[model samples]
Each structure stands twice: as C-alpha cells, then as structure tokens.
Target: MSHAPDLGSSAAPGAGAGQREGLGELFSSVTEDLSTLVRQEIALAKAEATQSGKRAGKGAGLLAGAGVSGHFVLLFLSVAAWWGLGEVIGRGWSALVVAAVWAVVAAVLAVRGRSELRAVRGLPDTTSTLQKVPSALKGHEEENHR
Candidate 1:
C-alpha cells in the first residue's frame, strides 16, 4: 500500500522545506508591496510640487502684467497733467511741479512699504511643528508595534 503525505501534517521533512519556501514567497511579496508604496508616494509628491510651481508661475505672470499696465496708465496720466499745467504756467515750471509731486508720492510709498515689510515675521508655528516631527514619528512607530 502506498501512503500519501497528509497536507496538514508537518512531521515529514519535505513539509518543512515547503513551509520555508512559502515564507520566502511571503517575504518577497511584502518587499515588493513596500517598494511599490514608496514609489507611488514619491510620484504623488512630485506631481503636487509641479502643480504648485505652475500655479505660482501663472500668478507671478499675471502680477507682472498688471504692474506693466498700471505703469503705462500712470505714465499717460502724468503726461496729460504736465501738458494741462503747461497750458496755464510755463513748460519748465509745469515739469518741475510734476516731478515734485511724483517724488512726494514715492517717499510716502517707500515709508509704508518699509513698515509693512518690518511687520512680517518668520513662520514660528510651522518651525515648532517641524521640530517635533521626529518624536511624533517615533511615538507613532511604538503605537503601531503595540
């Protein structure tokens, strides 16, 4: 009579070798899954960064266009004012008056801009949160192990 190896029985030497092979397959599967997850996360981060950069670039371009348009408007208005003043006073005095008005406006803007820049501080809260990241990760790892 021939005997068949019982599937559930591990008493046979061949069964032990088969179990080791199964463990090796499980380990390889886990490694592959982990590698795939890391690659997907990196791709997501890169896509997000690229999208943000594009948005920032578009906004900057729009801002530059607005600034140029505003400059042209200001230039036309200044010339019109100078010509209108020239019709009443002499051309030389009208030019001097326009120059003085622009200088005063420039001074006021510079002062305001300086004060506003001084008010802006560094990102204290974000810096504090980033400093705690390592400890937070370590605690999370401990919780997961438990």
Candidate 2:
C-alpha cells in the first residue's frame, strides 16, 4: 500500500497529560520509521538510475571509441595501401580500392553497433531497481556473488 504521509503524522491520537507524552513518543517513533523507509526508497531509486546510466555510458563510450579507433586504423591502412599501390598499381586504382574498403568497413561497424544498441534500447532500466533490491539488502559484496 502507498504511504499517506499526512495520515501517519497527524490525526492519530493524544489524550490528557500522561497520555500526551506517551503519544508524542509513539508518534515520533512512527515518524522516524516512516522517514527511514522513504529515505531508503529514494536511495534505491538513485542507485538503480546510476547503475543504468553507467551501463549505457560504458556501452556508448565503447561504441564511440571503437568507432573512432576503427576509422583511424582504416585511414592508416588506406594510406599504406595507397602508398603501396602507387608504387605498383598507380594512383587511380589505389584510390578506388581504398574507397571500396572504407565503405565496407563503415557498413560493417554500422551493422554491428546497430545490433548491439538495439539490445539495450527501450529497456525499462528504472525497474532495474526491483532486481537490485535483493542485492542492495544483501550488501554490495554479497550481491556480486549472487
């Protein structure tokens, strides 16, 4: 059941002087418990969101870094190929082969990254909180073993 914050704090009960102190203590305890519960829920939300963000960030960083590094590698390879071709096959054929190879590399990385990206897309990463709950309760190290 959803907590009605106001209901728990106000409109409970208070009697005469003796009961007043007792009631105040009771209310204070309840309030503390409620506050702790709410804080825990909020912390869980933040932790889960952070985890989901890191997952995407890592994936994106890898994809972008690999994409750039792959392109650079291709550039160097093409230059080397062109230089070699110029010595043997001449400029025109070297340019054509380099362009063709570059196109092939681009298409391959696009296809691969697109496929990997699709896996992570549209996942309700927020609900990952549910999965994390058990682990979060168990402590971080214990969670990893599980």
Candidate 3:
C-alpha cells in the first residue's frame, strides 16, 4: 500500500523550489498575523488592568482600616488631654480649649486639602498619547500610498 503526501506540508502540490508565493497568499498570511497580534495585545491589556484594579482595591481597604485606627488614637489622646487640663483649670475651660484646638486643626486640614486638590492634573500622558493616535494613523496611510 502507498501513502499519500501530507496536505499540511509547506510544499504545495506541483510547486517547484524556484516558485514564490502568490500576492493573495502573502496578503492573507499578513492579515491573519495582524489579527492575531491585535487579539493578543487586547488580552494582555485586560489582564494588566484586572491586576491593577485588584491591587488598588486592596490598598483602599487597608487605607480605610488605617484611617479608623488613626481616628481612635486621636479620640483617646483628646480625651486624655481634656481630663488632664480639667484637673488644673476646671472642666468647662478645658472643654472649650479642646474645642478651639480642634477648630484650628479642621481649618488647617481644609486649607491643605483644597490646595492639594487644586494641584491634581488628571491623565496627562494618556491624553497626549491619544491625541497623537490620529496623526500616527494618517502617517501610516500616507506611507501606504507612497
């Protein structure tokens, strides 16, 4: 019994060693490669974004816990200061002093927070790269025409 040649082999039937691939075949191969590359790139980006999102979520949760712990520390310190002063200057005046101190702290925090918010610049690099995309595409098209 004789076996037939494999259809999946690189050598096509009736093609000689000197033969080159047709334009249609070359174009088809390039298109397929480009499509696969785009799909792989998208998958990579999605995986990266998912990993970043999980990290951000975990960081936010830890920060919230830190905030609560900090608040309790401040509360206990404030109470201790008030009680210590009350023994010296009396209860009413010590309470007033604590309230005034907190008011000043609040004012300072509000001013600093506002200034920090004003300094925020959002997504500058992403915006710049996105703006360049159209020009890049135009350049590619011009090259193809040439």
Candidate 4:
C-alpha cells in the first residue's frame, strides 16, 4: 500500500505569522483613517463658525448704519412737519400735537414689543432632543442586557 503525505505537516511555516502581520497593518490603517476623519470634522466646524461670525459682524454693521441714517431722516421730517404746521396753527400748538403723536406711537410700539417677546420659544428643538437622551440611554441598556 502507498503512504500519502500528511496534509497538516505540508503547510508553510510562516503562513500564520503572515496572517497576523496583515491583521496588525489593517488595524493600524483603520486607526489612522478614524483619526483623520475626526480632524477633518473639527476643521469643518471651525471654518463654519468663523464664516458665521463674519456674516453676523457684517449684518450688525449694516444695521447700525441704517439706524443712524433712519434717526437723521426722522429728525429732519419732524422739523419740516413742525414748521409747516406752525404756519397754520401757532408754533406751540403744532409742537404739542407732534409730541402727542409720538406718545401714541411709543405706546403702540411698547405693546407690540411686549407681545413679540412673549411669543419667543427659546431652544425648543434642543430641549426636546435633550429630553430624549435618557430614554435613548435606557434603550441601549436594555439591548446590552439582552
């Protein structure tokens, strides 16, 4: 009877070692990729924050300019109206009438401002998401137990 070669003994000596080395290289590559991803995400966040801040600054500057120009316009218009009315009525009566008109406007503005302030719902989405965190954690705990 012919004897067959032992299959187990025919295997290469370095095969297991080569496989272990490949695994180590794969793990290192994965770690490096994850680290790079985190760095990229942080860079993106910083860039977005910088862009938002620049936009907010520009908007504030424009609003300030508009406010100053609007104040000047109102001042000139009020003076013109007072002079025109003074020709029909006396200067004192015309001034009093303008003062009363401004008073009514101030009252209306105050009431509207109060209503708008009351309508403000601060960070509703953030509040709702925060409330879900505990339930989410509980679900994870149940999964782990199973």
Candidate 5:
C-alpha cells in the first residue's frame, strides 16, 4: 500500500471532535483503510486483466484468420499431391484419404491446445506474497517491541 498521511490525530482533515483518537480507533481506522486499499487494488487488477483479455482475444482472432489462410495454401499443395497420387489410386479415394488425414491432424492439435490452456494457473506469485504479509507484519511488530 502507498504511504498515507497519519489518521490517528484529531487535527487531521475529516476528524471529528477536538480530542485525539484512541488506539482502538486508530487500529479500526487502519484496518478500514487497508480493506479499502485492497479492494481498490483488486479492482485495478481486474480492469487491467479485462483490457488485456480483450486485446488477446483480438490478437487470437487475427491469428486464427492467418492460420486459415495458411491452411488454404497447404490445402492447395495437398490437392496437387493428391492428384499425383490419383495416378496410382482412384481420384475420388485419393481426395477422401487426404481429407481424413487432415481431419485427424486438426483434431489432435485442437485437443492439445485445449489441454495446454487448462494446465495454466493464475496469480500464483501474488497469492504467495499475500499469504506472507501477516507473518512479515508480525516480525516487524516484534522488532519494534524489542
């Protein structure tokens, strides 16, 4: 969290009454501020992720279109090869056999991509850092008391 101006003093802006706040009040204020800060941080991260996701989606769509264009190039080459093979095999059977092989390759690639996507995890480092915060604060407090 960023450095914030002291909130314990009654002289601070938005302070009510002409008396200093107690320790409990100070702790409450700090906790409330921390909660607010965390909420804001989460909101910012979510907004960033949403924007990044939009950009990634657009990029993926463009890539898919490119892949289709490349596939057509390959398809033409495959057709030419199939016509050559048609000299030994029947023309209709040659086309069907090539189509079947292409279908199998596409299915395998699609399944692998799905599995790779599923294997990915999010926010691993952030989660570990957040888990350590309380222990880190406790050490700081112990040092302060000593």
Candidate 6:
C-alpha cells in the first residue's frame, strides 16, 4: 500500500562506496529531507490544532455571551416592569419581587449555557485523533511485517 517510488528502476545505488553514489549517503540525504518534511508537517498540524482551539473558544465565548445577554435582557425587562407596575404591586416590594423573578431566569439561562459547553471539549480530542493516526498506521505496519 506504500506510495513510495520503486528504487529498482532508478540509478539509485546499493552498498558500494565509489559505485556512482553511496547508498548510505543517498539514504542519509533522503532521511534528512524526510526529517525536515516531518518537522514542517508537525508545525502545520500544531497550527491547525491551535486554530481549532481558537474557533471552539470563540464559539464557547459566544454562547456564554448569549446566555449573559439573555439574563441581562430579562433582568432589564423586569426592572422596566417594576417601574411601570410599582402602583399595582407595593412600590418598595415590586422592585425586589421583579428582581427575584429575573434572577430565576438568569439561573435557567446559565444552566443551558453550561450544557452547551460540553461540545467544546471535543475539539482537542479531534486534534488528538489526527496526531494518533501515524502511530496507528505504524502499528499496522508492524502487524503486517510480523
């Protein structure tokens, strides 16, 4: 299943020091290139993971902002109601009563926001899955060789 080019047809060498080019030197150069490539790929992977984390963080922050804004809206509405309904309910007690109701509303919204945060935890797990794929493939290679 390897996609590597076959070395058989090429002018690539075997174990002869002066034979066109040393296989060890060729292998060393190839390994050096591979190492550089792997390092670059790792950097790219890290950047991708960091981006995903930022996106998830932004999403969670947005949800929290929504919950907070909802709470503020309800609280402000209750405050507005208190101003209007002060005559019907007792003047001093209406503000306290309205605030109590709005507090309950805020609590409910907070609970909902907490439930929504669970999905953000999956983001890092997604990146970890990607990181493990190479190791998993290497394990398969070992099994095949056995």
Q: Estimate each model's TM-score.
A: 0.44, 0.45, 0.43, 0.43, 0.42, 0.42
Write down the TM-score for model 1. 0.44
CA-lDDT, candidates in order: 0.58, 0.62, 0.56, 0.57, 0.58, 0.61
lDDT of 5: 0.58
Q: Write the per-residue lDDT of candidate 3 for residues 1-146, one digit (tens) a residue.
A: 65986765746544643345575676688678667756765665566666656655555554555455456557655775767676775664565566566555555554554554454444444444445545544455333222
- Please give the lDDT score at residue 40 for candidate 3: 60
lDDT of 4 by residue, 6-54 (tens): 6676565467778889999988986786677557656655666666556
| lDDT, model 1, position 13 | 72
Model 6, range 28-111, lDDT digits (tens) per residue?
876786677567667766766786676567657656766775676676666767675767656546666666666676666566
Model 1: how far residue 122 lies from native, Å? 21
The Cα error of candidate 3 at residue 78, in Å, is 0.9
| Model 2, TM vs. native | 0.45
Candidate 2, residues 74-145, lDDT tens digits: the string is 776777676776676676456657666666666666566555655554335445445565565445635633
- Top model number, lDDT: 2
Clashing pairs in 2: none
Better of 1 and 5 by TM-score: 1
lDDT of 1 by residue, 17-37 (tens): 889999999889867866775
Top-scoring candidate (TM-score):
2
Clashing pairs in 4: none
The residue ranges of model 6 lying beyond 4 angstroms of the native Cα positions read: 1-21, 77-85, 88-146
Residue pairs with backbone overlap in model 5: none
